[model samples]
Target: MTALPETTAKKLGLVIDLDTCVGCHACVVACKGWNTENYGAPLSDQSAYGAAPKGTFLNRVHAYEVQPDTGAAQTVHFPKSCLHCEDAPCVTVCPTGASYKRVEDGIVLVNEDDCIGCGLCAWACPYGARELDKAAGVMKKCTLCVDRIYNENLPEEDREPACVRTCPAGARHFGDLGDPGSAVSQLVIEREGVDLMPELGTKPVNKYLPPRPKDVLDEIDVLSPFLAPVAEESKGLAGWLDRVLEKI
Candidate 1:
């Protein structure tokens, strides 16, 4: 009997197309639903039926208004979570072995069993990726759906992170970033995607492509007839005489 080839180690990562994302929050909801069922502890909500309700989520979408004086206000909706950085500060800061980067796939994961909830890893991260899971008393963040992507029972097409699968606007893409031929790598090259807070030098594996600039309304207004002088007023002998004298 022939044995199957061993699965090669891959640097799995995500490339988010900010230009294409519609801020639908489908990816956030999908992540919550999947992680709740698969992970060690569910993301629970406190005071669900009362006021001051809150819950823990591995991923969250944030909306920001970016205004330029020369253009219209741009509404940018970006998802925030663990970047699974190449030089992950979270891993180095952990006194316990709880926070770690997977050598096989480059996913930053917290071993819940070993976590003491020191919150050091949270502070080490510049992107605000890590969050304390109050119910579990451990730090939690995006896992890239590690359990689902490698499942043998799942079809090849279905083997992807929940966020990528559920993104309604096709904003999310998942693949081996280390491979130059990979789709995610190609996208990063084509879009000139930027890392958030690059000055921190976490060397984040995740990439965010900036939104394309929209047309300015003020430019259109400048060409309207209401703003321009009437052609007839500048014509005839008076206009000709004025034009001739002005040339001097």
Candidate 2:
């Protein structure tokens, strides 16, 4: 394992908004498509033609049912990927020195040539960001779309990661977290963004914007009070609904 640089020049990372992510897997698809093609390794799937299939992906979205103390149940769509931590456990555990964090930009990367499929990095990672491409016999992870972000051949607007570019809800964002004036950093400050598993001490660079609390509206009457009297006059539920519609 190679020692991390004393200080990284730039902490380039992502800020994901849980409130806006719709669990549509748009980011997942776009991530897989871009990384598999742009990155050196080809992310392979096992038994893809069969009923049960699994594939290596750099990014994935998960949905969870969250119920607060006093409100309706809500679904939180969470997008997970490599955080490019300052003291990345995954990079430190690589015996072959294949896993390393870039001192210039803070992007954690795996050198496929040096990887021996030991799976230590994957196990060391608390965020499950490192994945083994069983078919390719090496570890894989998100590189923060390093290729596209630095490619001068592409249009300025298309320079961002595919996941950020393809998100229909605009839930994903990419920028330098090291610079306080950066847009992603301002978002973290404004939204009170948090790190995932901060206790583990990996010092993940990526941040997540927590879901904004929703205001309860059940107790508030949205319709006119005259509709209430009309509801009492109705004979059944359908009749009450009809009366409410008529009142509207």
Candidate 3:
């Protein structure tokens, strides 16, 4: 097991609030924007005008319509990305030492300069976090913006990853998961946050809080002014107009 560094600043991570996440792709776009420009290589799209066009993205949002045994209607939009696990399977499976966990902090990163374009890391990751960088002939995944977060030239507040900074609903938070007193740690405790696919025992550092229970629409009705009874006309045009407005 990789241990957290004591001398360096705490290892930070994201704690996503699933309850507040509206499934907006803002975070995804923000991640692509930052990584494509700053990371080793840009995520690419191939055969733009072809029928089998495809692209690579570090983060993706999955929309699931969940039907519970209790007959509740819920739509769960899970935003999937690299978990930066302590026992990262991707790192262990890499034959070329391209995938590694930082000793300075616990952040998992790929050494693009040393990569050999092996697909072992992608296959080992159950979360589907690793994607091949065809242009660079290596695997690519989220860096958590290592270059930006630790840069002294950047404003202290602007050091966090772009996704967390661009989240409009405030559903994303970045901080040290190692420190129990950190805001992210406290939020996880308070919200009973959960790990994705915990049965795999990857020990993911990032956490996701489940959405709260909500009432679903029970029925749909259509009202027509032409279908109303003639006797109801005595209620006056104003009252009839109000009912029509309400139904509409």
What TM-score quantifies how close candidate 3 is to the native fold? 0.81
RMSD of each: 10.3, 5.7, 6.0
Candidate with the greatest lDDT versus the true structure? 2
Candidate 1: residue pairs that collide: none
Can you tell me which runs of candidate 3 are displaced by over 4 Å? 1-9, 215-248
Considering every candidate listed, which one attains the maximal TM-score? 2
> What's the TM for model 1?
0.82
Instruction: Report the backbone clash tally of model 3.
Output: 0
lDDT of 1 by residue, 27-129 (tens): 9899989988896677777787787888888788899999888657899889877888887878887887888787788888888888899999899888887
Per-model TM-score versus the true fold: 0.82, 0.88, 0.81
145-167: candidate 2 lDDT, tens digit per residue: 89999999999999998899999
Task: Give the Å shift of residue 35 in candidate 1.
Answer: 0.6
Number of colliding residue pairs in model 1: 0
Off by over 4 Å in 1: 1-9, 216-248
Clashing pairs in 3: none
Of candidates 2 and 1, the better by TM-score = 2
